[model samples]
Target: MPEDNHSTVTEFILTGFPGLHPEYQGLVSAVLFLVYVLTLTGNVTIVFLFATNRSLHKPMYYIILNLSICDILFSTTTLPKIISKYWFQSETISFTACFVQMYFVHYLGTVNSFILLLMAFDRYVAICHPLRYPIVLKKSTIQILSITAWVIAKTGPLMLVIRAYPLPYCASNIINHCYCDHIGITVLACTDRAPYGFPALVLAMFILLGSLAFIMFSYCSIIIAVLKIANVQGRIKTLSTCSTQLIIISLYYLPRCFVYLASNVGITFSPDLRIVIIMLYSLFPPMINPIIYCLRAKDMRESLWKQFNRRIFTQKAQVPSVSN
Candidate 1:
């Protein structure tokens, strides 16, 4: 491909979910608005509880706080514009803005993946090596791990964004999905970007699959440890604690793997269904994460219940005791 001076495409028109009927766009947008609000409310409530409740300042809560933060950022990065696209019929996004959205979408996603890995590691240490968990995951150590996840996640998307930043887009300006993504945008580049994309894709897969593999290994060890318990009740209790994390891991990772495999394996699925699956994993996990990972914790539920009652009783009493 060659650079052309008079490229006509200066923006992209995102045809969100090609099969979504025109008449139902208003309903869809309304549902998305509710989903976005719920996602924010759930994740923010977790963050608030973690910050305010002294009892939650443990290794598990620390890692979970990062997950909540990542979920909020991920929802904010992707949802607003998609909502607007449907609600206001504003389907066109400028070229620069599209790539900007793409960058954050991938960046936050990568960060969340790492955070999940950290959670798995925390659970492993807690269950498999209970005695050393406290010493192994001190406050400073957890902080380091959280900061590393945020920092290291930027490498791949940064490289891809920088290389594609200057690429000429003359092929087409229509993004056939809900939002801009590296694959969708780069495919529009006039010149061959395989040289750049291959490496970036490799790095992304390394981060994704490597974290996934480690999490799986950690859980395997956790399973073995739980199994070694001779008492039936103890084994049941141990497995119950892990059940929530396993569900969240499956929610976050399985759909992603399916979407990736489908795209790469020449699966004969319909385009509409393919896009729907991608949208589901991308948006669904953040909305449900707080419910599954944070609220599912017994301590978290008790704290939330207490806080709710406290607010209700305080409001009923009409007391304004301000002490921030």
Candidate 2:
């Protein structure tokens, strides 16, 4: 075999939301900063609550805990550099670091899809097979599933990076997307991009649509089982629990499918517009997931209130004052 050619480009500049006006740069950075802060705060709070609260030590929240950690990691991997780009004008990422970022961006996303599938399975067992839910989805079982998701999510991303990273990048080093990804980087390669691009597209469709189909089937069964409950209150209560997951699932899957389908079917948007849509689906769910749990799930609300009251009481006790 001949020696592989080396890339000419040593660093890549991330052009976040390409064609973004100079006037709006600060505004976009501020908004993204707030989103990053909220994503971390919300997901971190969920993890804290799960760790400190014993009542949430169940299969459903265990899945949620996995998702929260994934969200935190995904946000951290993609946000800071873009925020720096728009705010502080620091945009260059080394060739090696760019691919490293690309790997996590794809890896964590695949992990999220798998975790959502696990969420659907948990709900399915709880509602469709209530008697066996505990037996089937114990903590140990959930831990194994979560571990498997994180491990397996690495395959597609690692393959993409391995195939793409070695290509001669003798072309432009400006990435038009907010973050480094398989498509954004591979398109710059000084070689035919079809081999790298096609596999990624197929893998993405498989992960998103395949998981989505199973989730839909699980919910359909859950709905059928829910309707059979003779008591109105029971049916309503069961649906209420499932509704939160539905909201999350819809937020995660629908926009993604639309974007991916639209891109392939000839419906086109400007690059900036497409990037904006991607960011919407990517960032919005993590920001609101914990809020959904608190507002929609009774147990989470009660636990949050308990934690809040405890903090207030501690603050009050710590205040030093002279008696009037």
Candidate 3:
């Protein structure tokens, strides 16, 4: 296509699960709506609990708070539009809007990886050098690190937008994925896509593998430290503290690595199956993170219990005495 032909495309249609049978759209939409609701409620409740409770105002909980906020923002960014796509057949997104969504989808994803890295570092310090943990991860230090992660996450996505956004889009505007992302958007550029696609791939790998490498190392160190503890009960207690984070990290990193790596290799997936895999890694973690915290983190568990008990007591107190 000629350079002059590039600016003709102004909007994109998102085809959510392109291979889905027409009859299944209603079911898929319902399920996605339910997931969206749960994701918001769970993550929002975490934020509310953290804000209202003084006991959770600590370094670990502070990291969790950032993760919760990212999850809420992430789900909000990607979910509603897809739900609308499935329900109302409202698939058209303006050119500017698609890029904006693309920015946030990748930006928040990068932020999440960084947050998990922070979490792994937190556990590593707490376990590997228990004596220095408090001094090392003071409130001010944690706050600074979290802010840095948020700031740093902006680079890759901004570069993506800068590189890919202005490319001539004389090709089709129908995005095959559920939400706008770097690959989904750049593939539609009318020019040779390799120059654009390769850099984005490198950036994606840098974020995923860089964070995963550090996280793996941190957990390994934690494991070594736990093994050095002679007391069986002590080892178990220390390991329990990190169990939730381990699960969250796995949920976030494993399938993502698989998908990204698989794509680069010769492996191929049907468009619908690929999107399904993407959604599994993307949506499942945010919905499940709060549940993991409530079940695994002692402080969060205690706080939830206290709240539950207080609510019960208030209800009981409100009941009228019936005996004569």
Candidate 4:
């Protein structure tokens, strides 16, 4: 297992859901396909709505626009290939594409994590300091925060790739998960792996725990501010608005914290179960995000409905009546 042996592995076979029954593969593939379509269409609609509607344009929404884009790109990176793996039995991904997917998977994930934190910050400002919120989170300020998040999120994944890309992969070429990620790819390397894996674990913890702490602080401040509102109805209104983001934040962070803890720490679990959880957290948020927005954000839903009606009416008008 010399370091020079990395060249021997040109592609990796993805062994998706290793414990799934053979008879259930089709069912699983069909279900994943439906999820993939729904995730793509829903996120795409959100991004389009943000782009087209001036009413939807604002700092909070600009943050949401980033989240929507991340959801779409992240799902695109993962689902189609995984669906094809189960459907067509196509599991081989070229070496370059594998790393490319790995890069985006982590990169977009980091971006989404920060976007959620930004949204939390936005809500905190708007709720706890409504008077100064506009002054503090002006368009210029929001632009800088968005750009900073993107730039910061980019670095960790590049560090991972730089450390992992050089490792010799003489050990194995089969990934026991649905997607390429730091652990999945680096575990294939023949080296001691601690040098790669440990740093990644630290980075993952830093991202998840750090963001969670900030979000909690923001929410705590928001809570205190909400309690100070003289009108009970106003307090309830404010809390209700945060319901969607709260649920989404839970989905995004909770599973990840468990996965990292169980995997990196001393917890023992079956390999298949671990992989399933990994895929679950990664896939669940993006799939549910659009639904959360539509259910929680009335303005986005109304704008989308208007757009949908316009398209339908225009289509009906364009259609020629049957002469038969």
Query: Candidate 2, TM-score vs. the true structure?
Result: 0.97
TM-score of 4: 0.92
lDDT of 3 by residue, 172-253 (tens): 9989988999888888888888888988888988999999999999999999999999999999998999999999999999
* Candidate 4 residue-wise lDDT, 1-324, digit = tens: 556534678999998888899999999999889888888888888888998999988787788888888888888999999899988999999988999999999999899889999989988888888899889999789889999999999999998988788788875899988988888998888778887788898897798788999999999998998899899999999998787788989999888778667766789778788877877888888888888888788888899899999999999999999996
Candidate 1 residue-pair clash tally: 0
User: Once model 3 is optimally superposed onto the true structure by TM-score, how far is the C-alpha of residue 260 displaced, in angstroms?
Assistant: 2.8
lDDT, residue 260, model 3: 68
The CA root-mean-square deviation of candidate 1, after full C-alpha superposition on the true structure, stands at 3.6
Residue pairs in collision within model 3: none
lDDT score for residue 136 of model 4: 98
**Model 1 misplaced stretches (Cα beyond 4 Å):** 3-8, 319-324
| Local distance difference test scores for all models | 0.85, 0.93, 0.92, 0.87
Q: Can you write out model 1's per-residue Cα lDDT over 69-156, one digit (the tens) per residue?
A: 8888878887788889998888999988988998998898899889889888888988998999879999889999999999988988
Predict model 4's lDDT versus the native.
Answer: 0.87
lDDT of 2 by residue, 120-172 (tens): 99999988888998899999999999999999999999998898888988879
